[model samples]
Structure formats: structure tokens, C-alpha cells
Target: MRTLITIVAFLSFGLLSEIQAQEKHEILSPQEFCDKMKSDDVQIIDVRTPKEYKNGHIKNSTLINFFDDDFKEQLSKLPEDKKILVYCRSGNRSGKASEILENLGYKNIYDLKGGMLLWEKAKTDCY
Candidate 1:
């Protein structure tokens, strides 16, 4: 009974750690997101539609429309090792994109708090 108890506790701890590791998603304000974008190996993704993207987007951000039928597949093409920063016109779509990225096994996920609207209000430069 003692040995069985020890094994169960060890297994439980391992499972807990794994779960914690997988829950590495974060939401960042415009300023915070800008700061994090400076880091190396970061992949900035704009989840807005092509029209929205063409209007304006963060410099160097890749377009991956959240509504696209192949959205998940497009996301899967990104390098899993890099940190992913996601945003949309408003915060809604980006939030959903961040969750999908997490579920798809991209470890480092960051969502812009208020998306492009807040970003523009914050006076952050866009391209």
C-alpha cells in the first residue's frame, strides 16, 4: 500500500507539472506587447482579415486571418520554438487565436490586450 501510494503521488505531480507547462498563455497591454516584440525569435501574427491587414498592421507581423478555413493549418506552419504574439482588429479574435495556438502546442503565446484599436490609441506605430 505504501509503494502504491508513492507511485500515485509521483504520477499526479508529473501530470500537474505538465498541465502547468501547457498553460503558458498571456495577455499583454499595448505597451507590454511592444516591449515583448523586441525580443529575438518572436513571431508577430495579425489575425485580422486581409482588408483589415492591408489598411494597417504592426510592422513585420504575418497575416493569418482567424476566420480562414485553414487557420489552424496556417498556424501550424509557424515555428513552434518561437514566441507568438497575436492580435486582431479588436481583442476578441486575437484572444481566440491565442487559445488555438496554445491548443496546437505552441508553447509561448501572447495576446494583445485590446488589439489594434487599443494599439492605435496607445500611439504605437503601425505599417
Candidate 2:
């Protein structure tokens, strides 16, 4: 009976921690994402290809090209201690990018919910 009680308590504590951990990774709206982008000390990764990125992208964003076969491996090299903000043309690829970040054990991950599409809609300044 004592063992059962301890096991249940441990399981509940673990679940609670997982729920809190999920909140650390966020999908930001265009406005919120843009606002956050203005801040310093974040690694903003644009997961679009070079051609797509050459067309337009958030100023100062680092290009990682999610379609690259090495996308997962390359992303894993990023410092896990730094916060990451990711985006792509329409948000789909960026969503996948954020998942990669999560799998890589990055602590803080933020993705633009609608990517550049919504960022332009919000009239956020960009290069």
C-alpha cells in the first residue's frame, strides 16, 4: 500500500512537470512574434531555402533551410541554452522546425504561427 501511494505520487509529479514544460515552447502570433523579434539575445532561424530566403525574410534571421537533408543535424548543433525563434514562408515548415528544436532538447522554442504571411499582414517592419 505504501509502495502504491509513492508510485502514484511520483507519476502525478512527473505529469505535472511535463505539462509545465509544454508551456515553455510556444507558437506565437504574428504581432507577438514580431514584437519578440525586436528583442535581443534570441537566435531567429528562417528555415526557408536560400532562393526563398533571398526573395525576403525577417532582417537578421539565420537561414537553415528546413528542406535540407541535414536540417535536423544542423539544428541540433545550436546552443540548447539560447532561446530560438523559427519561421518559414507559411508556418508549416517552421512548425516542423520547432519540433526538431524540441526533439533536440532546446529549452525555449517559439515559432511564428503564420510565418512570413501573417508577419506581412501585421505590417511588421522587415528587410
Candidate 1, residue 102: Cα displacement in angstroms equals 0.9
Off by over 4 Å in 1: 1-22, 124-127
What does candidate 2's lDDT look like per residue over 41-124, in tens digits?
Answer: 688999999998999888888999888889899998887767799999989998888877887778778999888888878865
Per-residue lDDT tens digits for candidate 1, residues 1-127, read 9999999999999999998766768989898899889889899999999999999899889999888999999998999889999999889998888888877878889999989998988965432
Clashing pairs in 2: none
In terms of lDDT, which candidate is strongest?
1
Candidate 2 wrong stretches, greater than 4 Å: 1-24, 125-127
Angstrom error of the Cα, residue 17, model 1: value is 12
TM-scores for the candidates: 0.79, 0.78
